[model samples]
Target: MNDHVEKMKLNTKKFASIGIMGLLGLVVIFGSVYTVEEGHIGIVKRFNEAKSQVNPGLHFKVPFVDSVESIEVRTRKNEEKMSSSTKEQMPVTVHVSVNWTVDKSSALDLFRQYGGLTQFEQRILDPRFRSATKDVIPRFEAEQLIQDRATSIQLIENNLIEEMKSFPVVVDNIQIENIILPPKYIQSIETKQTEKNLAAAEEHKLERQRLEALREVNTADAKAQGIVKVAEAEANAIRLKGEAEAAAIAAKAKALKDNPLIVTLTEAQNWNGQLPQTVLGESGMPILDLRNKQN
Candidate 1:
């Protein structure tokens, strides 16, 4: 009975030890396991020094010795209102937006240098963006800054990108939102624009009238040409008719010249086949002849 009781006691202690060991193992595993969410990068450090970086997923590390810091590698946005002077020494107020992200490849390096994302932005990004805006805004006149806003924004974005190339941050976008100018300058610009519009409208009107006048002149010239052509055609017809009548008269004269007996024949035909009732001598006295004939 004593031996069986001792065996039961030993088995109970063994099982209890095994259960305790399992629970400890579970605790260690749970503590070391970490899930890095999407758009975040994890830096693993052993003894407070960075050892390796893990991409977004489930990862495990040494429970107490290895530490992990997650840094967001996603794009972040910030806006700023900046005041600067243009090339002409006119003060301008501008609203700007900056989009940026921590380069994933340089995440560990960035963390080491800048400590955290918030620090990096507050200390480095903000100042550099402001500097870039100030530097680029002065290159253009105040009116150009307002009128050519796209160009101005591009210039600032390019400048900032170039300036930040040495850093571990990537500049995604820069937008110049609004520009405020002095009231007097704005009024002057408005006046000039109004005058320019009026001049353009007047020029367009004159050009339209000029084209209309040219069309009228062309129409008049066409009508005159048609009239001249008609007159020339009528004159040619009259000349041809006159020439035909003249030719007929000439032909008749030639026929008369060729045969003078035509006139005697014509005269005989007109005699109506009748002799004169009385024959008169040359002295205008009547003459009578008596003859007897047998037939």
Candidate 2:
């Protein structure tokens, strides 16, 4: 009897322990709070009224008194409409993208008003974006809009930056990927561009040819100038040399005229005093008779 009673007591204790554990599990699952992770914002709500937000890390709230809502604070994306701009009946499509991230500083305040970051997109973001796009895009013709994609995107970004400052959304970038024009317009643009390109190429080729011709003419002129300079130097040198030679000859003639030996020899040759192929010497010089020619 004692052993049976002891076994019953042990089983009861075990069942009680399991029931307590089950109750604790249910309380933890239903009543406790959890943290929203990094890159996430937690929105707190009480009786469907938004209270505040928490950024990352662990946080706690009253058990079963408040509920937590989580939302991504990172950038989001969507495919936007690219409606035609002007009444010119020109239909063009522009593929654009937007990059936006939640503002960490304003997360708590944003969550109180918006409930979650995604709510910002539905209530605040979409409305502002549509209004801004309608105002800005229709201001230009389709042709003008296609050409200035960057400018248009900039205007949209500025508008977003101004309006989204109140919310947690921060605009990082806005881009236009492509401009899709009507087939007829596309064909016209392509043809015009081709003609312009051809004209540019021909102009470039002609300029190159002209430059080459000019270079050749310049080279020929330089060579001709070099040859003329060399020829002039040679002519000057020859003229100076000729003048020097003439001066030398005049000096030699003057020296010979001043000598007595040349004059005496001329007189002796002209003498009617006879000259012979062979003559006898009188003193130390040869003497000839003048009357020998009459014999």
lDDT, candidates in the order shown: 0.90, 0.76
For residues 1-295, what per-residue lDDT tens digits would candidate 1 score against the true structure?
9999999999999999999999999989997998899999998989989878899999988887888889999999989998988899998898999999988999999888887788888998889899999989999998788789888889889989998999988899999878888899999999999999999999999999999999999999999999999999999999999999999999989999999998898898898875665556888776744344579
Point to the candidate with the largest TM-score.
Answer: 1
TM-scores of the models, in the given order? Answer: 0.76, 0.73
| Model 1, position 225: C-alpha lDDT score | 100
Residue-level lDDT for 65 in candidate 2: 78
By lDDT, the best candidate is: 1
| Sequence-dependent TM-score of model 2 | 0.73
Return the clash pairs for model 2, or none. Answer: 103-168
